[model samples]
Target: MKNNIWLDGLRSVRRMGETAVVAAKAGIKYAIEKPSNARLMRETFEDLGSTYIKLGQFIASTPSLFPREFVEEFQGCLDQTPKLPFSYIQEVLESEFAGRDLGDIFASIDEIPLASASIAQVHAATLVTGEDVVIKVQKPGVETILYTDLNVLHWSTKLLEKAVPKVKFASLADIVEEIKTRMVREVDFIEEAKNIDDFVNYLNITHNKAATAPKVYHQYSTRRILTMQRLHGVSLTDFEVVKKFTKDPSQVLITAMNTWFGSLMMCESFHADLHAGNLMLLDDGRVGFIDFGIVGQLNPEVWTASIAFMDALQKTDFPLMAENMLKMGMTDQKIDTKILAQDLERLFTGVLSADPQQILSSNPADLNDIMMDMVGVGERHGIRFPRDFALLFKQMLYFDRFMRILAPYTDIYADQRLQMIQTMDPNILLKH
Candidate 1:
């Protein structure tokens, strides 16, 4: 035990040193090239590997929590990682399914990966019974690297707090701890499988035929290896391809949004990451939802308040919005509702009045800037939102982007087809 602990300590130190060297080299190159700070930081995170890549992706997703510059620049932090050799993948499968022959379970697995990310690589495979599936295999030693990097990050956050006491108010350490917890859960395929199962159940119970998630094969899935039904679809970002799948892409977006909203009240947890890549237009015309690694769950109180908040926003009731925001967030002292309403009105008037064409053509960074400004206002008014709210808000922004492409002239809030608040059943809330 002692030797193992010593070895882990050595590994952490070595990893930290290696990361520092890489950062130093990148910094020197940036000094010579005079690149923007955000670009340099994104490059540095990419070079640092998995944990930082995940962090970069988080920053890219959560615009309300990050500065627009950082959020916009980190959007280039693509989740593609170099593919590991198939031999390593086979070894992991063998270890995960000990005493079982690979040929008995899978008839064939393509050597080339379908997609490779920092922590895992996915391969298209055929089961012995002839079902097509995708095998998501964890990269060798990724957990070790993740833990090392996360520890280094935790240490750095502590140092930052010590160096600057005011930074503690932001709860940097707590934030890092929360991130670590989620990242750790993400590496567990078993947990991810459970998340998908719950989501599928939610869809069934709600009679949502318009959306579907992958079906996990538990016999073939383990902690490091996830075997699931291979979805045939084009990403929502592929506008032309999506049009081929469904003639009315706007209905697709509405279905996706309604299904997602229903999951908030009905499912054990909601899909926390709904970026364009994870949402798809299936060949069957149903919206295919994939990647159940990240999910969010709100407490009953917060969930109720969030529902109220959405309703208030849609109704353009500033007072109700302020009241719901206060309910949804943390505030030690009472805030003047009148002041908050005035601020919200001032903040949203321009957004509400923006031309549809201009909004459709607007840069996502501009939208993020507006949302972050609203967050800044809330902060000044003594409201601090939970991270779960940020995750949901990010998905809403993604849905907005989809609408801009699929239905440029339509106002999502006023669209009769968008049954956002009406879809939430009071019975479902009671069950929770």
Candidate 2:
């Protein structure tokens, strides 16, 4: 759904207030120190209100757009919200169903939620038929609150655009619009059910055995109520537990990566929001991909080009890769081929040279430094990669960060993320 632009002025004032609060607290502390400050900021944001918490989450997913400290900080935003009481949950259901008795639909409901996010808290529940399921209930007044909060954000974006022309580069208004659309879709459980179905069907068609999604229940689902099968597993990011369950973490990682990669060809949209929290390790060691409310749609041309870009990036082919990106993303910009190639070459060579060993302890700051350089170059040259490319870059960076802790210095292109390609000897093909 499109964003309601009617509340533009109000939205601006609200966003300014939100930003002011964050700036006042964070700014003072940042001058003194920066350790775990982001974490503190996230806690404070959640404390302030739900809208800031939700905004923090959107920032977490779009790492390409934010500094690493903020992304890492906001990632914890979901876990900090105080859980709603059982009575509150009951009241929410009553309101949603117009005072209908919960006993009519649910035989039993667990008081403890499986996960409590900013907008909704998820609880494990069973219907009258004895089917185990998960229920995602919207927090009371979440829609109304979010609508008001989002209007403020939109207004703030508009004001920022007028106040500073540089804000246009960030696409503030469009970002607000996009965020509104995604958040609205998320509250629509029917859309999430479709996401589940699409992922399930994609897995079946690709013959992926190591990962699965929960079955979505349509009967009890509504705009605010999402009922899905209860999937049991440890999160994929839990290296210790995964080691206990499977002798090979590498094997499980391979299966998970392959399943995700195969989705590009078969799924309606790619799973755009895959953080560690959304992945699980089932009792049988298979991976569980949860929360499919947000996704990215890429044209086939861009998809093919993106795969080539990944392959090139893996091999550190900067010039050819830049050319491919232009082919996929830029059509009208008359890029001076030689200058673009040279600029890209310099940027990548520096990144590659920074960590030639791909060593276990290579500095991640080096990665950010290089990307920041690219961002600067784009600004200088009047070139900006589209949103999908930005999302893809963020995903790659997140994986890189994960690898730094899990398996430092090991080449990702050589190991966990490469099996989707069916080469008799993957090594030979990647050798190029």
In terms of lDDT, the poorest run of 10 residues in model 1 is 356-365
Q: What TM-score does prediction 2 earn?
A: 0.76
* Residue 341 error, candidate 1, Å: 3.0
What does candidate 1 score on TM? Answer: 0.86
lDDT of each: 0.82, 0.70
Candidate 2 Cα RMSD after full superposition onto the native fold (Å):
7.1
Choose the strongest candidate by lDDT.
1
What does the lDDT read for residue 57 in candidate 2? Answer: 77
lDDT of candidate 1 vs native? 0.82
lDDT of 2 by residue, 33-100 (tens): 76475676676677557777777777665555665677666655663467898788777777667657
Off by over 4 Å in 2: 1-48, 59-79, 98-100, 159-171, 336-373, 399-432
Q: What range of 10 consecutive residues in model 2 has the weakest lDDT sum?
A: 423-432
